[model samples]
Target: MKEVVYNSDLHFEHKQWNSELAFWEDELKTFKNRLSELVTRWTDKEVLAQLEHYQNQFILHGGVIENLQETIEKHETNIAGHSQKGDESMDVALVKKHSEFRYQMEAQRQIYADLKKEFFRFLSKYM
Candidate 1:
């Protein structure tokens, strides 16, 4: 008969979590650079006009960016409150912190995607 074993010691190790976090961090950095490039390219009048159109459509969506900003701020406040309490379990605290960071990163990613779409749309219009 073959013996089967489960590695219980590997269950809670955070190495994988750390690796994923690092990967997302690098990806976020790349997204930031791409957004900056698009913004920089907006100096062209056609690009600016396209951006304005995009912004108008976005604004019609009830200030989506502002809502995202507010949600991020709320997450930050929750994290800060938890830190100030100083009595929560480390695991719980870490989860909250990680969630807050994830939320911020996701917000950035959304913005980057929107910007990239607008930039490409502008390019297509001019091409």
Candidate 2:
């Protein structure tokens, strides 16, 4: 309940309700953290689990890429790591071609970035 003051807008207020506002406020404040946590998340277990799985997969792939990059950098300090498309040795070219060929072949898969990009472009055009 609100107290009436002459200067306040409730100066001519109805005094039907009692002083319960403070009690309610205190009660709600006490559950603030738990209530907020309950309200902010997905309630559907299946959907939530699916989303979590997708996120985990994305993170896993990202971590694999990070590891591969770090190893490549480390090896690049050695002779084998420094090889490119046109080095003097056929071994260097063979190594480069093999890695590139595998990646090129894998690019045909659904998960390939360029294929996904093209799909999105097509979707944007028609949709």
Candidate 3:
């Protein structure tokens, strides 16, 4: 039997995911600022190379976050349309999409977490 997914449940899940993404976006800003400060304080060739690498990674990650945000916004709009049309629960396709998004978000979170750990370990050397 197909599980019923109400609009309320989808909204709640999207909200939670949006909140997490926002937090990660803010953290990236903080990390970038710290990197700027570190660059200003030191000019060792190796350290500068590592810093540049992280800067690029953060930029890439930021783009990914933006893309995710836009995708979610579109999905929310779709949900709103369904609500307006009086759909009490998601269709199978919508349910599958949501499940796929959930998995994608989990993967992104893990990848970002690993990057954060690596960045911090590098900071430990000079900070």
Candidate 4:
């Protein structure tokens, strides 16, 4: 039988960075648990070392996701400030801010997608 990777997106809206972050965190935790279980049953030094490497990469990416969450929150707050100014006439600055926020979020999401893709490939092939 062949194994396939699973991809999910639970964001109901474009601004749901919080939930998007949680999804990545959950994936890492699950992968860590599975790796630990697999390691206990492995007797080969080479394979154990490889699993350890994956664990370290997972930790690093976990920190990256946390930073992305903070950035998204900051952008949302800044946009909110401009929004509270009311729908006045000609707020070019506000529009620019919103556009930048959306762009940042989209870029972050792509980074996360690549990270998760490699992580799952490791899981399906080794664990």
Candidate 5:
């Protein structure tokens, strides 16, 4: 249990998270393009409605991914600064904050995965 709460290097975690977010950001473009193709191929009202729903979701999650990326970048900068200055109190607080961010990233990834699965299921049905 104690090990679960400990991270030896938050910088590595941040790097990993940033890489994943970047991948998702790129994948989102592909998803949007595929959705566009679906729109052109299928004109049924129900299909359009579902497409719109996914479009909105993609847009929303895109913004979320950007925000998280910005946040992680800023935190990484802060971590570097702290390392140079050696502020123990600030380091402690930052570690606590990093844990929260870790939780948030995990949750967001799970949600994104679910969205992708549902999107694929829709494609299988209509495409």
Candidate 6:
């Protein structure tokens, strides 16, 4: 029996990428808001300790977001590189690479979302 393969339409849609990019941008804004709240509310020693912990977590979250952004940029570069080549055979490879890149981008986006959720969870402890 041959295994069935599913290709998501998001793999080829510019709107999908734009939508995901917008999602992450909103997530970053939320993180900034939480960070501001933590800073404003840190008055006592216990709160300060919690604030320190959140500060570390925020740095780690920022790093993951940066890595995901870099992966997206790399995929864009790879697609651009392949598109510049005019050969039909290269187009086939470009399609394959684009699919793989989309999978990778989606995976990274999920990771970013998970990290954002974790950040919120950590912030909840202080609230």
Most accurate candidate by TM-score: 3
What TM-score fits each model?
Answer: 0.36, 0.37, 0.97, 0.65, 0.89, 0.57
- Is candidate 3 or 6 superior in TM-score? 3
Query: What does each candidate score in C-alpha RMSD?
Result: 10.2, 29.8, 0.8, 10.7, 3.0, 5.0
Give the per-residue lDDT of model 6 (tens digit) for 1-127: 5332222232346446756666766766777777778888777887777667656665665666566566656655654564466321234455566568678777876777676677768677766
Pairs of residues clashing in candidate 2: none
Worst window of 10 by summed lDDT in candidate 3 = 1-10
Give stretches of model 5 more than 4 Å off: 1-8, 86-90
What is candidate 1's CA lDDT for residue 13?
27
1-127 in candidate 1: lDDT tens per residue?
5332212212222334344445544544554454455667668876666656655554443344445445545544554565577733334444555556556656755665686576567657644
Model 1 residue 67 distance off true place after TM-score fit, in angstroms = 1.4
Task: Return the top candidate by lDDT.
Answer: 3
Model 3, 1-127: lDDT tens digits are 7668898999999999999999999999999998998999888999999999999999999999998998889889999999999996889898899899999999999999999999999989878
Model 1 C-alpha RMSD to native:
10.2
Candidate 3's displacement at residue 44, Å, is: 1.2
| Candidate 2: segments with Cα more than 4 A from true spot | 1-41, 79-90, 93-127
After superposition, the stretches of candidate 4 with alpha carbons farther than 4 Å from their true spots are 1-14, 87-121
- Least well predicted 10-residue stretch by lDDT in candidate 5: 1-10
